[model samples]
Target: MNRRGFMKLMGSGAGLAAGSAIMGSTLVQNAMAAAPRRGGTIKLAWVDAVDTLDPHFTASLGSVKILNNIFNGLLKVAYDGKKVSFVPDLAETWEMPDDKTHVFTLRRGVKFHNGDPCDAAAVKWSLDRVKDPAVSSPHAWKFETLAGIDIVDESTIRMRFSKPYAFLPVALTGSTGRAGTIVSKRAVEQHGKAFGRNPVGTGPFKFAGWRENESITLERNPDYFEPGLPYLDGVKILLIKEPTAAVAAMMSGQVYGMSLSPFQFIPQLKANKNLKVYGEVEGNYSFVGMNNRRAPFDDPMMRKAVAAAIDRNTIVKQGYFGEAIPAYSCISPPMTGFYDKNIGNSGRGQRFDLKKAMEYRKQSKYQGEVNPVYIVAQGFTGSGGSGTRNSQLLLPMLEKIGIKPKIELLDRAVWTKRRNGGDFDMYDEAWIADLDPDETIYPEWHSGKPWNFVGYSNKEFDKLLSEAQDTLNQATRKKLYD
Candidate 1:
């Protein structure tokens, strides 16, 4: 419900009394009721599964959104869904006179769920802990790349960057990827390895319990700073990794919500009058990532040929729901500044050109039989259908261009091991975009910089990226990025 409407309903005793009468009614019915209900479990299923509850250690949408209730960053993007703009969260206000330095004034009267006072020292402790080399948090990359964070006072913090990085503000949204969520130092030191299971933050909800991969439950913090908010008494996240079953659970009212289902289900789900479907264009790109350290793809000409021959538009039209945009380049569309204009709109070079692809391949030095491997995980074995799709349709297309990729399917257990061990030529992969442009590209393409899975890098590309980060002027930065 909108804030104004909710306030109007809550203003009257009659509306609140009426709402109390409908506590056990259906959610949709309650939504239509004039007053907000105070208690119920919000069951949600996520597309990606969460492995750890430690806020700083992982970068997945499932874990981050769940933690949104349990942790508060120094600053956060307003929930209005406009361009990402920072607003107060733990910090009441912040200022930056130059591109390299920033100062933040913390909000007072805020306490962790465990009742520890949240002061500047707590903020500094959280920030400093993330940069520890032993910790190497998935979200720690945000703090480690900076020059340093200096604690100014019990309610203030000053940050200095080694270089002029423009994406700092956007990074402090929460504890996932670029988002940096604040943690209570006392809680961590007290709990040690058990902290992930029992986190303490100054957010709307407090940790209740976690049942491994089964479910995670949370309770509302009675001392929540925002009065009359969070509405629900608790949130329960069920780790149902299978997307199809997740959709079914939502439809049956076994769960309140879930991430998207197969593209084909959108129309059917929309037709259900009892359900509400929400959507927005996202910064996600799925592709066949080639192992640049391997034989055929190790040849840049062959890589170029594969890039040239793939019919990306056709892939979008047939393989995925018509929802997907054709992508040839690495950057996804939602990332505003980093898209290279020279690269095709889909982010790759261009549409299929068999002649050019063959020419590039013939120009390469390798003449032996070329075999590429496409690896897929086989572990979504429960309610969803088989984990693998038919690769037969792709063979004809590749045969016409004189390329063959032998398909390999591994169980989830083996796939995890093989992936980290670098066991295959190519693997189907997906990358969710960070709030800033630099976070989207740096970890993927910068050579010798870890997370560069493709093993492809260029000195010129690194120079451009370095220049883009330091250029404060937006236009100049875009030019340098280009």
Candidate 2:
């Protein structure tokens, strides 16, 4: 993809709206007007506690958000109004010699929290570590296109790809992708299994302490590359699971910010004169995943029936309180190019149709009961609780269509294992879009991929995706994706 295609793919109108809502907040506007002031402690509250500080191993958004403050990637994606752009972070400048080769000029004078030099070797180590089979990083799949990393000098490195991947730099963005975040090699070597607990990186803040379910603390990195950044002297992240308790804490001035706000509590928060609410439509979506590896779901008719039976509008209204948009395709709306708008609309394609659902169900050989599991992740509430609520709504709908299905709620860990291990007939699955469309589409839908827990396989779809990736022309890629 060219620069124009890259920007268009990343730019989502909903994402812009979300950013505007947050940035236009009273507090944010006031802060923007004032000169940078350093030395105040910001107490932020999160509904979930981070299991690890290591960015490579972190799969949860909660952990990734915290890791972002403590790690610096080669490049970062930033939104300017509705336009998505890539900015230099650890790597000050880069040049693409060819479609498959990217050479980056690292920024000098950068240091990891452990006092290790953030040089070309460090970047190589960090990238290679993710691909290391022994490490088994959750983000290893992001670097599958990476052929090799060669250190050209103390402050320069060359990245070779197997094919012409246009979104390599976009994939390196810190916020969404952790594969490019440079870590302290010495720190990892010394800590080994304990590295995640005592993580070190070249970020705005330094990891201080983590008290499991209580809190995680980070102090200002005095040796930070960007001068007088972070504004706050320290950051204290409080682990408050309950929405009511979190709102109470915020009301009482005990917490300055809440990371993932509950949708039901938004009206109450907006009503509070002293409080300010910031939000952005994130590039994420929740979906009902059918296990194609097993009977019933293995049949295309059964999958179609289930999809037709789901009342997305009701789920959006009741589960998300009208905060979320109903997703039609696998790709969310925030992903502009890849999203097929006609897929979920009435008359255009799949929608609530009990009659059609029953027709499709009758075509299936296995007409027995279907058991769907609802897995609840950390900080699950009104806004992010689509999985739990959507699954509940699906139960009666399935029954109405003469299909017997039982819903089981499982903890995140157990649910993840069962889903990945293919031990479920059906389940709720969600995804946050990476900087590129391939990040969202390829892994989940591609046959035999690890994240393709539903066991979905379509040779034609795979061929289209492969062609899209190999093609350099943006228009052709968009056509292929469409």
Top TM-score prediction, candidate number: 2
Tens-digit lDDT track for model 2 on 1-482? 43233223212110000010101011110112236666888887786446688888765667878888999899987776554667889999989899889899999989888887999998998899998878887678777788999999999999999998856665687646777778899999999989889999989999999887788999999999997687889999898777678778887788888776666677777778777776655655666666777765777777777766777777767766666666554445555545555654434334567787788778877676655443444435423544566666767877876666666677667777887788877766656545567776676767766577877776666666677777777677766655
Candidate 2: clashing pairs of residues: 18-280, 18-281
Spell out the clash pairs found in candidate 1. Answer: 328-346, 328-347, 328-348, 329-347, 329-348
Question: What TM value does model 1 have?
Answer: 0.84
Over 152-265, each residue of candidate 1 has an lDDT whose tens digit, in order, gives: 888989888877776676667665333468888888999897888888888899999988778888998988878787898898878776667777887787877764455546
Listed per model in order, the count of residue pairs whose N, CA or C atoms clash below 3 Å is 5, 2
Per-model TM-score, in order, reads 0.84, 0.88
Position 285, candidate 1: lDDT: 55
Best candidate per lDDT, number?
A: 2
